[model samples]
Target: MVINLAMKILIGIPFVFGLLVYKLRTRHLSTFNAIENFLRSQNNLMPISYSYSDIKKMTKGFREKLGEGGYGSVYKGKLRSGRDVAVKILGKNKSNGQDFINEVTTTGRIHHVNIVRLVGYCADMSHCALVYDFMPNGSLEKYLCCKKSGIHSLTWEKKQAITLGVAQGIEYLHRGCDMRILHFDIKPHNILLDDNFTPKISDFGLAKSYSNETSIVTITAARGTIGYVAPELINRGIGAVSYKADVYSFGMLLMEMLSLKKNLIQNTELSSQYFPDWIYDHFNKSKDLEIGDAEELGCEERKITRKMTIVALWCIQMNPVDRPSMSKVMEEKFREKFNLVRGGFYTDEVQGS
Candidate 1:
């Protein structure tokens, strides 16, 4: 009887082990399927997986140098199909694998004239890269900071157009997406300009999604660039950071656009301080409105340029609520005269009152 009992137990052990293996395999497949569903819902056009070898060849071992961002350095390259692409190769030392995935998946879903397009990505565990439509003019940062050599200086009109485009892009991300996308980080470096000087918002690694029903989500760590960071980030803890933070960043960006100077050190004065505040501080004065030298302007369109500056100040108000929505910004910008119904500067409410 003892021998027979041992034989039955031995057989049962193998059976149970086999069953466990099968269940584990099934679970993994199910999880993969769910992830796939989420990607589809986000309108991702899942490009075929490309190996690290393929990318290296396409970029000629990353020969053509483009500018670098927080995550990685971008290289201009040509694909197998004679297509031009901007390849962002993530640094092994600086960023993580998750950031690459976020940049790819978040940008892939977003399709807008004002927003940059993500062509594809490479995730080989060790080598990470992001492919995007090549923008010849490069980033807005180059113009404001570097002063492109021998190139025609940025006209006041061009800057106005760029500002309008960028505002519209942000507005679209907030309201147009299936889920509201908070850029979290908005700066001149992230704004890429095409051949025609159209602005496209890029770099979505830090982007977060929220629904209209939910407000004030929790975050453990602080994220975003210096100077462009909203006041809420410094005073309150991480969790308090909200969509309004993005508005503050936008305001800072506007200040930079007008002053044509790096406003981070100046913006830190707090309470809509720095260039935007300075502009508003002197909006009533002719000299202040002429921050951008008229000589830089090709045409004698002074009145219109002054109005654009006022709109930018409105965007950078101390209170997030006082800032106009991206859509409203676009409408008011193109209009001959923008009567901001919500009186001058609201420091209490994040959105314009």
Candidate 2:
């Protein structure tokens, strides 16, 4: 029996290794051809293709690094047309090319003023990269966590406008697109600001899309940053994950816009009250707000600020059912109840698809 077991183990080892090698080889080949496959297929819009060598030339040998993520690093690059672009070069991961495929296909189909523009992509052999219009102001995160004296604090007007753009962008994903998309990851770091301080949603690596047939989806695993993940994603008992999950994440992001920068549960001495509860209580009672720099805002600006604050608190409600959907911004009930700005907070708005 021991001899038979040893013989079986030896045979199974080769079989397992061969199977892994086959899968890897298949993935490697598919990744090498993903761009071509995407090009031949039908899409709402067709972003051009770029060669790997072209990426190197544009990125100047990856000299100016802008940011890094679990999958890869982003570099500052300039296109031949003299346009500045941010290039994302995918890194090694066992997901093979699944993430690169998702990022390319997802961003390629959608276009909204608040959504980042996908200019082109590179998928030469195992090397893959995505090119996007460069955001001059970088991410909303730097401002949220900034302590540098040189970093000019964003005015109340700018803060509200930026968050409003982000909200609209997320709403577009949920309702405006041909396919309903849930941005499983929505955090300050994923929100980019252009020269005008208009926020554009970025980082589609974790995006999940559903057909117009259904708003609810059952993902195999929870997806989002630690602080921004909805309670439903973490505990099934809370609710089924759906578009509301994205709403919950946006709530967390908006809550931080009020200057609750750190996770209060982990960082604050106000153990008696949940952070959102504190904001809710203060805003309702008209108590003096210690939020960021709100005390200095003028009366009109403060009214707008407090109104948005209420919306933010409403977003972070513990139950997914209680939270408002992103598209609810369109409804009169949402408009009157949340008092979300009459028009968008920004002026001279232009949308590019």
Candidate 3:
């Protein structure tokens, strides 16, 4: 009996030691894998891999200015293949390295027809820039708000198509990826228009990704442009943050598209009383609104456009839950048309689709 008991103890000790060794090895492998993924993600984040010198040669010392935004100045360039590109140079010694990393990490991996493509990047000290496929038409904001271009390039059908494309791009960002990507910024300016007039969603620097269980990401300070920011985000200091903030911004963008007006009216009775708050309140009081530049649209087109305005209002509802999902937005745009009309005019300003 004593010999058998001693044998059992010796075998059990070896078994326990072996289990510990296996566990340690597994953990070490996991850590190594994470490190590997981070490095690999960084290495391949930007699609274009040109050396800084090659980029300078293409831009000709940043000769042709394309545009400027909150990030930096953009210059036009043509690659060896004769493909035009937009080169965005970040400010020298800029403090927003994290934003740069986010742009590279997220935008680099995303490839879709409606989303802007990141052709390359330059991350050397004293200089940081991102290269993207040059969008010839500039942004939707320019056509809608800027008057410099005397003629109206965007027709009624074009507006509908642009709206559809933008929605599709946002839907792709939210649900098309392996992870859920929240575009913390979704204003008109972030939406670029291609030569073909397709709306391509751009600027991933302010975006955030979350897992299924994460309801919110901790933010040290408020992010996103004002007027376009969601109410919850504006009030983020008082409560936790969530992805729904994005939905709210989308709502604002929708309203902007509907009205063809910037939502930044300050100290006006209209903004405090009617702009956002009135959208839903007016909807409740009356199911739709007749909005848009009436001078540009025909009576029949104006009626159809009103239906779209109603849909936009639906998207911009104060409650995130009230806003439809991106999939639903697509369905609303394509699946059906509203017949709510008065004498060949849809009671609403535009059709939802």
- Reference-based TM-score of each model: 0.74, 0.81, 0.76
Worst 10 residues of 2 by lDDT: 344-353
Q: Taking the tens digit of each residue's C-alpha lDDT, what string does model 2 give over 146-214?
A: 752446567767887887888889989988988888889999999999999999999888888889789
- All predictions: root-mean-square deviation over Cα? 9.4, 6.6, 13.8
- Clash counts per candidate, in order, are 7, 0, 14
lDDT for model 3: 0.70
lDDT of 1 by residue, 169-214 (tens): 8888878888778888899889999999999998888888878566
**lDDT scores of the candidates, listed in order:** 0.70, 0.77, 0.70
Candidate 1: list runs displaced more than 4 Å: 1-43, 46-48, 94-96, 146-152, 237-240, 260-290, 295-300, 334-353
- Provide the lowest-lDDT 10-residue window in model 1: 341-350
Off by over 4 Å in 3: 1-46, 147-149, 212-215, 237-240, 260-268, 281-288, 334-353
Top candidate by TM-score:
2
